[model samples]
Target: MKLYHSTASPYVRKVLMTAWECGLASRIELLPASGTPAAPNRDMAARNPLMKIPTLIRDDGSELYDSIVICEYFDSLAGGTLFPPAGEARWQVLRRHALVDGLLDSALAVRYETVARPEPLRWQEWIDGHSAKIDNALDALEREVDALPAAFQIDQIALVAALGYLDFRFASRPWRPGRPKLERWFARLSERESAKRTVPT
Candidate 1:
């Protein structure tokens, strides 16, 4: 398998962490790809029209994309351990995963507006809207931190990746100030070998 990856992408980190947890990390060959909205990676675009990082080329000449799909594929390959098979537990995990992914999406949008856009093109209203989304998501996650499982699953992995991205790009905002439980949970997860190895530079 081949993965088009970017170290700074939280979505890529989610896929990488999933691979590690599923014991499929060694099987993947990471191909560095840095793509932006204006300038996409040709190679990644060829495989995935969206030109997104974390695109996977399977050995059988098939392709999978986006972090969630790729992570679910990895889980399936590992005999389905990462996600709950059915019922309310499954919904909860999936819900949390979607929320964290949404948080990261909003964070990335704010990042692009503030850091990628030129000074005159930057829009304070846009940045503020996305920032508000991130703040609300963090508050929601903080409220549910006690319910977060200790096990390595898609929800937990996605949360960690989102938090890592916040630390990487928006450290000035300080996400841990009032979210003690979430902070402590992330602290423990940060010590894991998989998390340590995949920390964005």
Candidate 2:
């Protein structure tokens, strides 16, 4: 398998981490790909209409896309327990995954608005709205830390990716102040070999 990879993309990191956890990292090859809304990788459109990173091209020449879908594919391929087979646990994991994705979406919105958009056209209100969403998500995670699964599932992998992105791209805005449980959880996960190897540059 080949993955359209971008080290700076937390979504890509999520897929890679999932692959590593599933013990399939050695079987996959990484193909460098980077882009923004202002300049997408046109070639990626052939494999993924949305032109997103973390696109996977299987050995059979078929493709899978976006982080979550690709991660689920990896888990299924490896018969990994990253996803619960069925029950409330599955829904809880999926719900947490959604929260992580929303946090990342808001973070990326803030990043693009501040870094990609011209200063004169930047909207503080839009940035503030997303920032609030990020904070709310962080608070939610902190509140639910005790309920977090002991097994490192898709949601936990995504949380690591999301928090790692905050550290990678928004270091100046520390998120560890009051969210001690979340911070500590991230710290433990960060020490994992998979997390260490996939750290964004």
Candidate 3:
């Protein structure tokens, strides 16, 4: 298996963390791809039509992309190890994963608005809209932050990654204020093996 991704991409980090948690990291070759969106690397586009980071090409020549799907696939490979087998726990994890995924999406939108688009064309309103979503999601996450388990489940993984990404891209934003529970949770997650290994630098 070959995994093509950038070193500092949070989305890619999600997949890498999944692979590491499942003990599948050794089976895949990690490759770096061109970061240009205008002329994304042909090899990546060949596997993922979207030319997205974190494209997984299996040993059989099959391809997979997108962090959410990739994480679910990894969960399956682990015999449903990362997720609850059934019932309300499954739904809670799914809900938290979905919320944190939204935070990642919003962060990307804000980053692209600033870094990809021309300055004159960049719309503060669009950035503000996405940022509001990220903020609200963080607030909701802080509410039940203590409920997270000590393992590397997808919800906790995605949530910590999402919070870490905010510091990476939006350092000036005040995300830790009024969220002591979430802050403590993130601090603890940072000590985990996967988090320590796959942190975006």
Candidate 4:
């Protein structure tokens, strides 16, 4: 199996963490990718039409894109440890995963606007909107920190990945001011083998 990856991509980090937790990391080879919306890499486009990092090529020559799908695929290959199979537990995990993933999306948008766009072309309103989304999501996560599953599940993985991205790109706008619980949780999670190994370069 091959994984098209980027060290700075939170989405790619999530997939890499999933692979490590699922005990499939050793079976996969990482292929550094330079694909972006503004300038897509031909090699990555051939494997994933969306030209996204964290694209997976399975043993049978099939490809999988999107962090969530790739994580689920890894979970399946590991005999379903990362996700609950059914019922309310499954729903809760999925909901938290979605929320954190949304937060990551907003954070990435803010990053692109502030860092990638030309100074005159950048819109303050768009940046503010995305930052607000990230702030609200962090608040929600802080409030629900106690309720977060004790196990290192997909939800936890996604949340950590989102936080990692914020640290990587939005270091000037610290996220730990009022979210002590979430901050502590992240600190502890960061010590885990997967988190320690996959920290964005």
| lDDT by residue (tens digit), candidate 4, 1-201 | 999998999999999999989988899999888755667777777788888888999999999988999999999988967899899989999999999999998988887787778889999999899889889999999999888777889999998899999899889999999999999999989998999889999
Candidate 4 root-mean-square deviation in Å: 0.9
Model 2 poorest ten-residue lDDT run = 144-153
Q: Give me the runs in candidate 4 sitting further than 4 Å from their true place.
A: none
Positional deviation of 134 in candidate 3, in angstroms? 0.8
For candidate 3, lDDT tens digit of each residue in 102-192? 8888888888888888899988899889989988898899887877765568988787678878888788886998999988888978887
Q: Order the candidates by TM-score, highest first.
A: 2, 4, 1, 3
Pairs clashing within candidate 3: none
Query: Is 2 or 4 the stronger prediction by lDDT?
Result: 2
Q: After TM-score superposition, what is the CA distance of residue 8 in candidate 1 from its true location, in Å? A: 0.8
Clashing pairs in 2: none
* Every candidate's lDDT: 0.89, 0.94, 0.83, 0.90
List pairs with backbone clashes in candidate 4. none
**Which candidate ranks first by TM-score, i.e. highest?**
2
How much lDDT does candidate 2 score? 0.94
> All candidates' TM-scores?
0.97, 0.98, 0.92, 0.97
Error of 4 at 57 (Å): 0.7
Off by over 4 Å in 3: 36-39
